[model samples]
Target: MEGSAVRHFTPFWFSVEPVDTLAVRGAPALLNCSAHSDTPARVDWKKDGTFLNLASDDRRQLLPDGSLLITSVVHSKHNKPDEGVYQCEASIESLGTISSRTARLTVADGDGGSPGGWLRAVPLAIGRAPALHLCTPASVEGSHAVERWLFSH
Candidate 1:
């Protein structure tokens, strides 16, 4: 043994994934992304701008060199006319192609409650100062009705 010592390696980041906004319309939603290679890779998918050709369409499966499998995501009826923008592009040619920052599938314009649908819940499902009726001794207007805050809880 002639003293064996060797330590020199560098790698801050080689893989990073986080692009799949949200979707919920006709069910069936799976939009995941992953990338980062060294020797094996072949993930390339696109949408919105259009460029997603899974050979034809056998489920668009591929989970070896990371992920990016989005199959069956039908959501486009709110306002119609093509609806909002939905994009997802990811390529891998030896650490190249990185276009994934647009994921938005919002199709909410039917079952939101009923009759005007609560105005479509502002700020993402009700946020404009909800919950009313308060009391503190300054209760001199309807005597703080509504069963005292619905039985105090």
Candidate 2:
């Protein structure tokens, strides 16, 4: 066995974990997740501690890079399906599964009682000078457009 090449297997690990995100109702949202390992890994997702079946859900898509994409955020007084805590799980046949940090998705209602309206402002603090946080949609197409503004009064 002289001059034989030895292969070192790297343990599976998450390189990019999903982060908390806020999406306007009827807009798309994405939860990023990336993993690395010596063996090919399969990716799955969980919502509210329950396994999410992306195959049955038409509005949801699992990207090739292990990211979950919501075609449209669904939120209403009667039904809010897209807003929940989510986690990404990666697994290999020979290795145990590894889970990423939990990320929460929040759906915000549109202003003026509209569903697709993209302008909203939240007051962070109220004092002699109030701080306002505003999120507006950008003019980009096919991309998640979010513009934030901080105003100190």
Candidate 3:
């Protein structure tokens, strides 16, 4: 062969894979949001639709696997807004942006051993498929990516 050509391309996509997390009140908690991408991507954590300030807070830290970890879960009589829905947003140049599944963080009043408590309050679902959100650019300029929701039951 006189001349041969070989080409390689990186797949631009974002994937957040983390199951629902449960934590006891007044204990340590870890909110996971691991993202995978063929290229570099920015991962941001959000709680209750508000962006979490991981850089300024000492209690909050972004793990090496792109997951957010809360040092100590706080639940008091005065304020207990820390327990809520948490999600992670990952964005890439070619992949656009994608939001992870909403994870409900329920703080139990005790060690989760009492009957009819937080454990029992939560419902269990069978034969549920995982969700994946994706945003692909149309022209990379002045274009909005259309979203398509896919579900299997």
lDDT (0 to 1) per candidate: 0.41, 0.77, 0.61
Better of 1 and 3 by lDDT: 3
lDDT of 2 at 35: 93
Clashing residue pairs in candidate 3 (N, C-alpha, C atoms within 3 angstroms): none
**Decoy 2 TM-score against native:** 0.70
**Number of colliding residue pairs in each model:** 0, 0, 0
| TM-score per model over all chains | 0.26, 0.70, 0.61
Q: What's the best-to-worst order under lDDT?
A: 2, 3, 1
lDDT of 1 by residue, 1-153 (tens): 369866444222225443433333332333445554444445555556676666677645545544444454444444342234444444544344556555544433334432322212111213212121222233346655232321110
Off by over 4 Å in 3: 1-16, 111-113, 116-153
The RMSD of every model to the true structure, in order and in angstroms, is 13.6, 10.2, 17.4
Q: Tell me how far candidate 3 lies from the true structure as C-alpha RMSD in angstroms.
A: 17.4
Candidate achieving higher TM-score, 1 or 2: 2
Q: Order of candidates by TM-score, top first?
A: 2, 3, 1
lDDT of 2 by residue, 1-153 (tens): 799977666688998888887766776777889899877899999999999999999999999989998987788999999999999999987668999999988777855343333434343445322232354444454676655565543
Residue 114 deviation, candidate 1, in Å?
A: 13
Which consecutive 10 residues in model 3 have the weakest lDDT in total?
116-125
